[model samples]
Target chain A: MTETPAKPPARARIPLGQRETVAGYLFLLPNMIGFLIFTAFAVVASAAISLTSWDLLSDPEFVGFQNYIELLTDDPLFRTVLWNTFYFTFVSVPVSTALALGLALMFNTGLRAIPLFRAMYFLPVITATVVVALIWRWFFNPDFGILNYVLYELGVDSPPNWLATRTWAMPSVIILSVWKQVGYNMVIFLAGLQAIPTTLYEAASIDGAGRWQRFRNITLPLLTPTTFFVLVISIIGSLQVFDAVLVLTDGGPANATRTIVYHIWEEAFVFLEMGYAAAVAWILFIMVFLVTLLQWKLQKRWVHYEA
Target chain B: MTAHGMNRRRFVLTTAAAGGAAATVANDASASSGAVSSRFHAPAMIGQAQTTLTWAVPGNPDEIAVYESLAEEFMSANPDIAVTLDSEAADFEKFVTLVAAGTPPDIGFATLYNWPSFAERGIFLALDDYIAQDSYDLEDFYEQIITPYRYNGDTFGEGELYGLPKEIAIRAMYFNMDIFEAAGITEMPTPDDVWDWDRFIEMTQQTTIEEGGRTRQYGYVQDVRWTFWQIWAWSAGGDPVDNLYKPTMSTLDNPAVLEGYQVFTDFVTSLGTAPPAAVTADQGHSEMFAAGLAASYNNGRWMVPLFRESDFRWDVMPMPMKTQRAQTLSGSMFGICNGTDNPDEAWRFLSYVVGAEGQTRMTELGLLLPSRKSVAESDLFLNSAPPTNNRIFLDELEFAKPLPLTPIYPELEKVINDQTDLVLIGEKTAAEAVAEMHTQFNALLQGA
Candidate 1:
């Protein structure tokens, strides 16, 4: 005897788009929760703390904008640190970006061993900043440092005390930062270069364009978006330079290399002025925001986007 | 298809909610771990409750081993209490972060300079009650070393005992005997021989050696930092501040202070007796001295262990006197955290560390001068090692003054250090540097 056919299971009635949305949110939930708790919450809390005078141990006292007022009107060190940070960023970012682009162009020759050479150049980016700073500190030593020794051997009677002299301390730091950072930007430039079609260069060559002419007209114009990205990121990174300065100079030889972040750190941790440090942090945020905004606005003038 | 999609969406939404809830549970568990009681119940097998105390200390590997052995001995004696050592270099910022997080170590080590700030902020538990209850003999410690842990009204060293001294440090001159002999100096200055400023300079210049347009050896290398500079200024009958505590004004503009600063700066910028700022900037005073590149190095007892390993002969002598023989007193001390859940257990460990046993162990290590009177005076410390004149550290204790201990000491230090660097580099004269330092320091004090 034939048994009654088993009824087929009924399917769910939800829409595909809704299901996908739920799945997407589930995947993002973990990271979103972390970001909200650690980053977003911390930012808001720091802003609140900035309005109050809190030593780490004592209960915070509400003091409105007193910290900001004092820092702006009375603190001579504040002005000095602010100027030093600006000088570091302005000098390091452009110089490093140019050096990175030049290196990237030289490396993109499609040679048999180009990958090896590129990896060699990218080694510093993978090294720890503390280690790099320490090594550079020794190299910059005026007495037995290899840098000074080499200069002495080259018939130069004396070399500047790179990290100790006021006139040369910031420049020494800038040189170190460039050496440590150029590799990362170079990789980015290489990636950007690879994304550009070789057909454009071929056509230019057929049109009798020389190497310099093609690079100036086609390569540079097309690389504007990448250049803008590099410029913005480099400037932001330079503004927060602390590890190198902390290890190399300790903001010494008369605060020659004391950047804003270092000042904030000393105020917050060393001096135990958490509230003032928070205020300085906010000032830094505003300064970075303005600079980035200016960069975005100015990008339209030169950053060409390919259709 | 529509029904299937709807069911899938519902399932996804449920899963997502469950995941979020699970994450919340996991976060709560992690957060609670910090506050968890470290006591482990063992069904009262030993018929006593077990309590754990965490001690945060900073030292090198050898020192840490010594501490570990001490903990073992402490645990064996006090079986009811378990001790855990948290080894870290003394870092105030990290300590503050731990306190802010509400999980401060039960017992922690703080430098003498930082003890006041910690006490003023109420981070440390005043040990008066504990000391009174235990009848701990505070007089057993050298008054100079223990004075730093006392916090009085608006100043350090008079109010209440918040910490106990772990070790006492006093700065003196460490001379390279070989270098001095090579420079035709047959007789080295002893602790009793009080060299004046002029005599000191002449000896320093004589010890310096130059060859092939480069200095092979420097006569003296002053640290030029605030702590050492204060010693010079004090010996010259001046001080950075009128009072070490509750300082309302800077005494940097005192003529004697200027004279002291001028003498030190001239070593680098004028007399060329010492290595340039550039040279010391890299090699450091200790390294240069140890490497035989300098005839004399100015540092505290902490350099004993480092110098003991050197190939050259060296010894300690009193710092030259400009007006009076003065030395700088600095040290580390152990304090119980105010937020500690186990204050009694912590005090037991803290007392043991700064007690006779602890000081004796440290004396054996020779890294620091013991704070205990018995240990400091006994052959344990006095006859220690290479520095046959270890007595100089104790002999000068009476003259050793604490670095300024105001809450604003760090800020005051930065101002003086920065201005001093300018003087050392020849960018600013002693007069100009001290003038600026005075104005800035006064402002800091007023603001504080």
Candidate 2:
């Protein structure tokens, strides 16, 4: 055995760099495989599809930028949809973010049954969007809706039809989005709030700073990072809003509630214009990327970091 | 970042898992059943195996029973071929979507009104070749039933034909005798005795009365544009859909149609003879007539079933026509799937559905008036009566006109419905609404 060991077979040794590379690749295997199979492939396929006319059957025919051009200029509903989506994103994002931050601050303060309150507030975030949209639809119904009934009790001469009136539809949709979104963002901001040291508030108190002054000086500045994150995420989420709109309004009552995503859906599924829908999808992606980039650029002014 | 990242990761993981689970389910189901697994699956072999064909139909429970019985007979006659009947009451949209998704049954029921749309989308198999080769008895079908299925000027009737009429329904006035009696009305309105706007209003008023300070009854409700258009257009002495595929609402400026619309709208909005806007589609006129809440409702021969179970006596007369004998024709068509793996079997099933024996069986079930002219008029159909007035279908069939055949009819329908609703709701004046409709309709037509 010793003689055999002494004459042991030549040990094969891999180069350190090569070994390290192999290990790194192995570690990244799952994610790389996933990206290749899912994201990258999907993007390429969708882009290719964007140039082709497909009606879910038969072979697709390449139509170049015909779909894009139609969506931009010739499509009658595009401008209306873009404007509605933009309006929804702008109004709902800021209002929802503010409400979320306010709620986070309240919950961050040591309160009894804080976890229970947090869970209750986060309920809507966990509930299905369809169920939420349905509940909101019923609440907004003109004749017998609880909202209108409450308005009636308040002696308002004529409460506006929450989901019906063209003027009220976008606002109602925005209200619903804000309600559904506030919970998730609130939790995120609460985490950020808890992470901030209590010493800052104490230091402000030691300096005889009022509650409003402390909040304006310390809380707002310190919470800026979380606020920026929430703002970006919420705005991006709001822009692509589709499910609720599909279930509730169907972009109806004179196409008042038609969002860009809804238009894309109609083009793809209803009108069987897959190429046009793909183009719309790409356009939406670009718009979201640009908006997020703009937010990132803007964030430098207000976002604060410990480092 | 940690909490949010964790939540995001969990969500992604769960979504992936759910998708995997769904795929697993699909795989398992298909693995067990060859037809489901392969989607475009070929028929399975069991040595010297027999083949089974499937028919997809949209109908009420009674029609499903008729289909099942027909399938039994078909399979019994053709011992080598088995037949499966699948029935769903889901609308044509669902059926079309399912077919487009590539899971179409061997044979299915579709409406002639929607035949062009289906044909354009490639949901249907053209049976011209089969018809020419087989020398099928194409003359047995009613001329009206065959017209809608013909594209490119070729008849493909009954043998995996793109579509053949399963039933025929013609527009008529379905009057509730109970409501008429309550209104103290002795004579019912007939096609020949057309009511002027004033007389129509007076009749609606006399028929519509408030009992105990709540409006318990309605005299009439304005029908939707499709049904109402025929009456108004024929009254105005114009066709509903012109040869140019334009809505004859432009022709509504004609005194007769204008008067017809005025009378109709007044009966609903002005005379309080119709239900509110909320239930107008499903529960307005026809449902009111069924519930003994309306003296008269304008519908079609198709809706006699509402009175089948009703305690009150009911009857259908020819819809009051203004100029010519007018009735809007609407009916379902039986067609084979274009992408069916087994066209031979599908054609066999189609032949049975559109053939004399199949039509007689369908008639006997009282689900519909058969498309075969002979079957429709046969002692078989005339004698098999649930309401005891099966002859009304034949009477109305003579005046029936198939709705306009256009691929863009759905979009046109939306536009027309919107305009009609606006005019009815008094949101827009009839002239303004019709003008708007013309503009919108022309735009849609051009786009299509």
Candidate 3:
């Protein structure tokens, strides 16, 4: 009667979707916690630090907008670095993206050895930046560099000191960066090109469209989304260019190649002006954010979406 | 609540309780073992718990090995004070970050130029108390080497000792003997020879060779570093700053300083005694000298190890004087971190490294001049060199002045260097660059 025929215990009923949601959140907890702790918190902390005068070794003092004022109004080096960053971003992004698109188009042909050629082109992209920078430094050397040697053989008696002269230093850095980065962007472009429906190209060709016309009408418009993505990411990356400048010229030969990131690093770590560095970093962030927003607004003009 | 919900809650509570019990048991087990061990050796371990000290050093692989062995010897001597060597490969920025992070190594090797900044910021612990308490023989170290580590009364090289001397880096003229002989120079300047700036320039011009509308051989290679320029300015009886310890303004406008600055630039732009700034920018001065393309290069004693591998016969001579003979003294030093919990242990390690033993090891390595007078004077340094005139470094110490040791020295150096580059590359005149430098330097000083 234990025996009264005890009914089986009622199980708590949970909706399938609710359980799935709980499980999903549980699964995401680790990564969410890590991102919050490391990235988000660090960013917020740095923002707060921007309003203070923290030398890292000593106690932080609230300096309000002094760092910002000094950076904007008084610091000539900051201006130079900002200009250099802008110059690098404006020059490198467009040139590299165009070059990448061109390379992608060339390699997109169904050749049997296409993989090998792609790998060969991508080798510099995979190589360490420092190693690449060092190699290029030697190549750009006016006396013993291979670049100058080739220039000399080609009847140019005096090749400019590529990394030394202010006029050439930024361009030299741009060239090296483009060469190293074009392969990466090319891979992205290749993926974008592959995703384009072959029907459109075929239709264009059926209409007696030439290669250039088909590319201009079909390929470029369809690839705009990828191009926009590449542009935004490239601009952000180029603005933060530090490693090549550091390894190649050390912002040297009179601070010609010194970019914003390099200046921030020097201010933060070298000069121990953490607050100033934080201020510079925030300024960079604001610039990047505004630029991205502008790009979003401008994307309506160029970026096309396939229905 | 549903029966299943109650069961689930009970199950969770039971699991948590079990986990807590298991954790307690594990913790107790460890605690029991720890207690037993402590009780067994409590008499011996009363007040001598092990202290692990971290030492950060910046050096190449070879130098790191030397430092490791020094640390090893130190640990062996002091068993209670364990040491961990952190090699940074000469990244000063990383070292500063460590200090800023407040987890700085107990002892850190830093550049003498950075000493004043660290001292002023209270990053480096003042060693005067430790020295007085230990009765440490401060006299053993060369005054010039230790001078950079001193900061008192708002002046460097005059007050409390913040760091012990690690090396004596005195710049001297390293000339290629073969190049001089090939140029038909019979008389070579010795350390004892009082060669003036004019005589040095004459010798440089005599050795310079031009062929096929190109300078095949450069007479001298001047380093582009601010320190080398400082030596030139000092030799000309001009200085970048009026005060050695507390620099306030640029003295580059001084007549002698301007003359020295002009002469240095003329070596590249006008005289062609040395390669233009463009060529040197492509190639290092030491590299050019080692390649025998340059007859002479003025650099520190650290060049010995690099030049020893060269095929050419090279020797050191005193820097040519203008108004007076002057050389810039610079080197790395080890200081205890103020935030270190183990100051005594740190000082013990520091003293061991900067003491006679460490100096001897450095001397044997031939990578640096010994900071200790006895070690520098010993045959170990004098005999262990490719440049036979090793004594020139020691002799020059009498006239070697420490670099301006303001907290803003790096900024000041940047201003001077940038303006000087313009002059060297023929973009600006000496007066114009110096005037610009003065303006910039005063602004920086005021800000500091």
Candidate number achieving the greatest TM-score relative to the actual structure: 1
TM-scores of chain B, in order: 0.89, 0.79, 0.87
lDDT tens digits, residue span A67-174, model 1: 999999978899999999999999999999999999999998879998898888788898766566766867888877899889989989878878778999999889
TM-score of candidate 1 against the unseen true structure: 0.90
Q: Judged by DockQ relative to the true structure, which candidate is superior, 2 or 3? A: 3
lDDT of 2 by residue, A226-295 (tens): 8889988898999999877765655754577789898887776555677888999999999999999998
Please give, for residues A162-251, the per-residue lDDT of candidate 3 as tens digits.
876788889999999999999999999999999999999899899999999999999999999899989999998998999888767778
Candidate 3 local lDDT, B256-309, one digit each (tens): 877777788788878989876556644456778988889999887777877888
What is the C-alpha RMSD, rounded to one decimal, of candidate 3?
11.8
Off by over 4 Å in 2: A1-42, A52-61, A99-137, A161-164, A179-182, A186-211, B1-46, B49-109, B120-123, B128-143, B153-161, B167-235, B244-327, B353-398, B417-427, B439-448
Best by DockQ: 1
lDDT of 2: 0.66
**DockQ score of candidate 3?**
0.30
- Measured with C-alpha atoms, the lDDT of residue A141 in candidate 1 is 80
User: Which is the winner by lDDT between candidate 1 and candidate 2?
Assistant: 1
Which is superior by DockQ, 1 or 3?
Answer: 1
Computed on C-alphas against the true complex, the DockQ of each candidate is 0.41, 0.14, 0.30
List the candidate numbers ranked by DockQ, top first. 1, 3, 2
Error of 1 at B378 (Å): 3.2
Query: Worst lDDT window (10 residues) for model 1 chain B?
Result: B1-10
CAPRI band for model 3: acceptable
